[model samples]
Target: MQQFYDFKINKIKNLSSEEKILRKKNLELFYLNGFPSKKDEDWKFTDLNFILGQNFTNIVNTELIPDEKPFNPINEFEHNFIYLVNGKLISKNFDHEEKDKILISNFDYKNEIILYRENTLNFLNNALAKDGFSLEISKNYKFKKPLVIYNYFSNSLKETIVNNKNLIILNENSELTLINFVDNNSKENFIINTIDDIKLKKNSSLKSIFINNSKNNAYFYKYLKNDLEKNSNLENYILSSGLKLNKFDIEVNHNAEYSSSNIFSALNLSNYEHQEIKTLINHNTPNCQSYQKIKNVLNNESKGVFQGKIFVKNIAQKTDAYQLSRALILDDKAEFNAKPELEIYADDVKCSHGSTSGSIDLESIHYLKSRGIPEKEAYQMLINGFLCEVLEKLNENNLKKFLLKKLESQIHGY
Candidate 1:
């Protein structure tokens, strides 16, 4: 860990005087705190021992850079593309004619927005990040094609720990869709941490989709802190199918009136893969709303976890919040854990939360089978219906189709 401090000091040796001072401050704060453990309330269920125990003496040195690499874009979409390979920005593509309509920045650290202060993971990202990116959508601007970011982890990574920071901003009345696609092909054990700071100005809206199809040897964790101003809205969708252990901790704040946020997560894990989705929704102002729904299908000895909390302050009257978690345990060895909480201080609020877990209903299966349907087909139909509740919320057909394809590949034989 001491070596990591030296690496940061050396990495920014060429930077401006101000950058050097700020980077060192962040690194020092992290070095003293270390990583989180089971004692931490939020990280109680998830353990970082396996990855942290490695005691990576030094950060991995990689030749891969995001601003120079060439990669193929998704064929069905006509959107801008950002490519990140091995924790570094490799390429960003915005149609030449529309380049001015968007703003893209990298490795240019900003001191104003320090996210998740005192949190070990957030500090670690800033202290050891290879590079970072910031994306902003201009005011009153709207684009049909979504912006897609592909994060690739190659199999060559050995005895390495990667960290990345991503920031996104939307001006007033601007609307856009952002997709983060993680493709991990690494065969050896690897650890990567991502920290994202997102702010939505008044009346702006953002639709975020995260698709993870990592390999079994990778350990991936992400922390996202989002702020929503007045009349702004945000929709978050997460689809996870890989990684030896993966977790996404997202905290959303309704900073002003009339803002709304909704989160939909679908996780499918087989073999020994494990994933956890933790969300914190804060209603700080009046007349705001939030909702969360999570669905998990665990196979073999796989494990899934969902922990969500909704906090309503006194001034946040008339807040409407809802949460639910449902799990389908395919094999007797599979596991699912859920903790949903609501803390309300206002008298005028509608908040509810519940979790349910069970195997395929034999009565429903028998009913379908009695109508000449095969047992396997009936089971597939049931699973599809259960998972579609979340996928159907997607507004874009292209994204919906892509997600459906991934879901089909995982749910077919279960």
Candidate 2:
């Protein structure tokens, strides 16, 4: 393990003595476990240690100095934008929003606290993370347009690991729509470990969308922790399809009554690509609801996995939770795994989970072909319809159209 990776706390700039000590301690702890493998229950389906060892012979952490690059804004719809180069905030524009209603700055590394001791990735992030952003929306304010975070990586990043942590807070009665757009075109094989902490205050609402612009050779892992207060609502839409390797570990805690959350994901894995989405939703209060729907289309020996669990507390009466995973395996070598669980202590709660995976329906494809559609076009149409169902509940028209276009491109493997 020591021969494959090299990490030093001095690489991070501007740290106090105590902070450096804490970071070194975390690094030692991470070295004890290295990368997670099948032995870990949370990572049993995906052996990250073996995967990284196969791809990278040597990995190191380095400081990234932002180089000037042409910034392209998404013209599909009106939006505020923030540009990030290798996880470092570079520039931002909020012309469509009131300046006083939004707050944006660098991540607070000084006040960091250790939250997750069980996850080795979290420990690695705490030790090596150097760049990230903190964003907050003022109380009672709603953005006039969605905010697009452009995540761009430099072309020179090869065999380097980038770790970062982010924080987002939505005050009471505030609402915001955020889009995390990955715009990396680097052909280099690198690793990215990120942790995001999000808090939604009373009556606040947040809609988050994740998408990739093109295919790349990056390995990505993100752990997101969400806290929901009374009457708050959170909706997550994930359409990440172009990465070589990826995993998303999401944890949502319904801290107060009447809170609700929805997780919808649509993934198209081609060739040897692998992706997984793991979620744990905790209903700590009464009358909280959660819904999750995961859809995957695998082709040419690709792999996909979904592990979702819902927990209800003893006092969480009337908790309603539902989760379903469906996969369309287009090739004999393709694979899909699903593990759905429910741990309920409240007798008055309602929860159900199900998973289904199978090959594409030949009868439907033939029917489309007979209706004058070309065979290739028939297959594409069926796939588009199969994965687009997850986006049906999105009310934004232009955003939905943009996402649909991206999803189509990924399905065609362009």
Candidate 3:
């Protein structure tokens, strides 16, 4: 492990001048923070011992490519595909104009903002990533076709650090739908760190879908921060399927009045898989609304966590905030931890939070059996109904249908 660390340091020392500065800044931040420990309230439930203990030495170069296709099951889905193998963009599939909108080749960030990003996990991607695609949608330009960003990893001992600084500027009265899939097809241990930054102008609408299907041996760390302007609406769905260790951080800031934010997440855990989703919503202006709902299904000895909080400032009167979390435990060994919180200084605001952890209803199952339905099929139907709420919000019929099929395949195994 020490040798691997030494090798990584030596390799990074050979990077270009710009990359060197980023790397130096990141290393300093990492040394100070040291991968949010269990002592940190937000990280108390997810364990990182396995990832920290591994001998990860490689820095996946752009020259290295994946010989195998990561996604064969859902090849029929129509999408504007931006494929990444081992953190590097294949370039052939990328459109220059579209790419520029999503990625910023040069950025001049303020000192405080830079420091915040550098100390965050996103910085790991900025420092170590070989390459990744960027997508920018024009202001108020609606996308008729679904935009799909696929992150693929296919090598053992390889770390794919994808630092994506996405600037989604939506002008007034425009709308779009996006499907993002973070997938790992390799049996090898890979690490992924991703960042998605979005800013919505007045009256723009966005529907986003996130799917994480990394391999059971992989570790994924993802962050999404959004800035909502007045009268803009954003609906988000986060799906966690495969991976040994999965950690996610999401923050939504209501910068203008009359904006709305809805966050929905579903996690399915099997084997020894571990998952965590931590989120925050801040109401900085008056009359903004935010809703959060998350669900988890744990089987075998898998573990899961959901931590969510909403803060309504004193000046943010007429704010409405709600949060809910539910977990289904299939076995005695399976475990779940939930922390849903609300902090409101505005006396006139409406805010509430709730959480539940339990197993499938036996009575519901008995009723299905009494109707002569087969046990396995009946059980699957009940499970589908439980998770359908999140999928139903996709709005796009084709995308919803596709996700339902994927959910079916996933639920049957759970």
Candidate 4:
């Protein structure tokens, strides 16, 4: 590990044009702020050993493009499909008529970028990104089709780098659904860094689902920055099933009054795997509401981590905030960690945070066994019931059903 760190330090001087510039910036920021360690209050639960011990080789392999279309599985997508192989979008699927709401360009790498200034992970993405999709939704434009983007990693020989950029602008009183799918069928090791910038206009509603079903050896680094305008609504969900290492960073800025935000996540971890999710909600205006619920099921020595924070500024009075993290350990060796926090500067507000971790319900399992059901089957039923509480809140019925099916597959595989 010591030698690997030294090698990374020495190789900094030999990077290519784009990589050298990014490396210099990343090294400076990483040195000044340092990696978010377990000792750090915000990262106390997530394990960083796997990421810190190895120095990944950054590859600029343009030949790593995926020829297969990402939307081939969906025959009737009601929305548009913007496909990305590695990081670049497929040129054949580009549409010019949607320019107002969707734009594809090399994201400007300016130092004055608002979202990446103080964020360590965001800094890494900006400095080391290869290519990405740029999506913008128009104000007051209603679309019938959903916007789906498949991020495919298909290289085996070298460790690839993918940095995706998404810009979503929702005009006042508009609505849309977005699906961000990360699918990897490769047998190689790689890294993915993506940034989503969302700006919600007044009275707009946006629903998004993030699917991580890589089913391969990969690392995921994702960050989301959302700014809510007055009287807008934003709903977001995350589903995790694969990958060896995954890290998610979310920042929601309530800039206007009467805006509401909801964040929901479901994770299933098995074998020797690790997953971490970190969220931050900042209330800069008055009368905004935020709700966050994260649920996990861990077995076979896998680990799950959840760290969330809600911040209420001095001017943000009458803010409503709620956060909950719950985990069910199927085995004695399985692990789960939760850190729920709240910072209130306002005089009048309602805020609550709760966390619970335990095994299957013994009483329920006993009752089921008494009814002629096997012990294992009874326990699986109990586990499914406990997880459904969060899934019920999902607004999309199809998505909810999809989540349940995945959950079943994960538990049965264990």
lDDT of 3 by residue, 265-324 (tens): 877788888888888899999999998889888889999889898989999999999899
Residue by residue across 1-414, what tens digits does model 1's lDDT show?
Answer: 233312345543355566667667777887675567667777777766443465344445343333444554567656777888765676787773266768887755655446457377777666566576888888888865788888877666665567778889999999988888777655777677888889999999999988775445777788888999999999999886777788899899999999999899887778887899999999999999998999998889998989999999999999999999999999999999898988999889999998999998999999999999999999888887788679877868877887777667567632
- Provide the TM-score for each candidate, comma-separated: 0.90, 0.98, 0.86, 0.86
lDDT of 2 at 324: 95
Write out the backbone clash pairs for model 4. Answer: 78-145, 79-145, 79-146, 101-136, 139-171
When 1 and 3 are scored with TM-score, the better candidate is 1
The model with the greatest lDDT is 2
- Of 1 and 2, the candidate ranking higher by lDDT: 2
Q: Order of candidates by TM-score, top first? A: 2, 1, 4, 3
57-134, model 4: which lDDT tens digit per residue? 443323344565534544433446677777666653424235565554544444324347545556655555545655
lDDT of 4 at 93: 44
Pick by TM-score: which candidate is best?
2
lDDT of each: 0.79, 0.93, 0.69, 0.72
Q: Write the per-residue lDDT of candidate 2 for residues 183-289, one digit (tens) a residue.
A: 88889999999998999999999999999878999999999999999999999999999899999999999999999999999999997899999999999999999
